[model samples]
Target: MEAVDVIEVSREAIWVALKVGGPALVIALVIGLVISLFQALTQMQEMTLSFVPKILALFLALMGLAPFMLTVLSEFTVTLMDRIVALG
Candidate 1:
């Protein structure tokens, strides 16, 4: 493949990764922030307090978003394969 084709594929790959990961990441961020606030308010500074909520939130987020994520990943994979075939 040409350099531009490589770059295009790489960019698409990155975008697909970001799309797939974005929901869980965003959910974790929000959960972490809320947990931080709660810990601050309660003056309970336990480092381990962060993981459980974030993990649970991420799991739920992933479950909720799985279908959409799958669609995005599948579309990207198909598009990339098609591009590769066309280039070949």
Candidate 2:
């Protein structure tokens, strides 16, 4: 409830967000870079060429990593709930 508590909570929330999302973000970044390179090499600038693969890869990655992501988010939620109870 104090400024320090708020800052701590905010920092934790950001960390949890990153933990949950970082994998997908990394996958997307790598996929995008690879696709860009391929496009550059092949001289194929089709819009779908870049977007479709990234979307599919991201979806597959999210599916594959769902359990880990769920565990992290659940742990963070439990931590937040504990803090809320303590505050109350």
What is the C-alpha local distance difference test score of each model? 0.89, 0.95
Off by over 4 Å in 2: none
- Residue 52 lDDT in candidate 1: 86
lDDT of 1: 0.89
Q: Which residue segments of model 1 deviate by more than 4 Å?
A: none
What is the C-alpha lDDT profile of model 2 across 1-86, one tens digit per residue?
99999999899999989998999999999999999999999999999999999999999999999999999999989998999999
Q: What lDDT would candidate 2 get against the real structure?
A: 0.95
TM-score of 2: 0.95
Task: Put down candidate 1 lDDT per residue, 10-73, tens digits, no spaces.
Answer: 9989999999997788888899999999999999999889888898878888888999999999
lDDT of 1 at 53: 80
Candidate 2 residue 23 Cα shift, in angstroms, is 0.8
| Lowest lDDT 10-residue stretch of candidate 1 | 79-88
The candidate maximizing lDDT is 2
